[model samples]
Target: MSQADACLRLNGVTNKNITISNNVLYCGSQLSIKATNDLTGASVYNNAVNGSISATGIQSCGTFAISNNVFINATANNFYPAAGSPLINNGANPFYQALYDYNGMSRSLATPTVGAYEYSTTNNSGCATTDNFKCGSSTASVPQYSLIS
Candidate 1:
């Protein structure tokens, strides 16, 4: 990762043994994974993103791959994949897969989906958002703030 003020969020970085997995990161189109210090054991896998993954950093013992165009309405704030989405079963074994997604839905351990949310064949309502965020069944906007004098 470049040590510049970019529009990406990567913290607590080290030379080795770092994991960045199971995320739906909207890291623009100029995103990449680089290891300048000959980094090893970097796990970057099972992600549905519009970026690139390079194994140029991992010397050995790590998973690094990228699945492209794996969303139905990513740009529309609906990160859920359609029925025929490649993200359905394109992910490798997650580092530590959670039992549920951001929406608190059960996840498939055998055939894990990429990103924070899993593809739900039972639900076709799509991810509806409000104020650029996803809430249960609905969303909220017009953030309330107070000025402390």
Candidate 2:
């Protein structure tokens, strides 16, 4: 997989708006999404990839944002977030909800997790007594047990 070609390749594109989300990509050395120059607008969100992503001259159309993406280390030719991972509920509301994750599980509009699959388990050990979650200087107010089914 290290010497494999790009998973998704777009070369010499112009005046195009690209959006890549809610997918799991695993590779050894191949790039996940490779876009050449002249990209007008792009939104790369809510994706889990084990390899790198490269885009040249990508412009921001105000709505252009890259958030909620997870780059995890590959293990045994697979990439997956562990249980009780901080990736849960770390994602913000996207421009459009895909309605489901890579696993075809329903995804909520509020407090979406960062990655391909929505974490179906919640880490209640470090959470506040209420629905709030705190981490050092950051205080995130997420739905209680939202990760759980």
lDDT by residue (tens digit), candidate 2, 92-142: 575666566544566767877665556674322232222222332344444
Q: List the residue pairs that clash in candidate 1.
A: none
In the range 1-149, model 1's lDDT, one tens digit per residue, is 56532223444446466666665545566654433344445666555445554435543323333354556655666667666766676666756766766656677888877666677763435346545457644543322323359
Which lDDT value does model 2 have at 136? 28
CA lDDT scores, all candidates in order? 0.56, 0.51
* lDDT, residue 3, candidate 2: 33
The per-candidate count of clashes, in order, stands at: 0, 0
> On a 0 to 100 scale, what is the lDDT of residue 120 in model 1?
72
- RMSD values for the candidates in order, in angstroms, are 7.0, 12.4
How close to the true structure is residue 139 of candidate 2, measured as C-alpha lDDT? 43
Give the runs in model 1 whose Cα sits over 4 Å from its true position.
1-12, 32-38, 53-56, 59-69, 122-127, 136-149
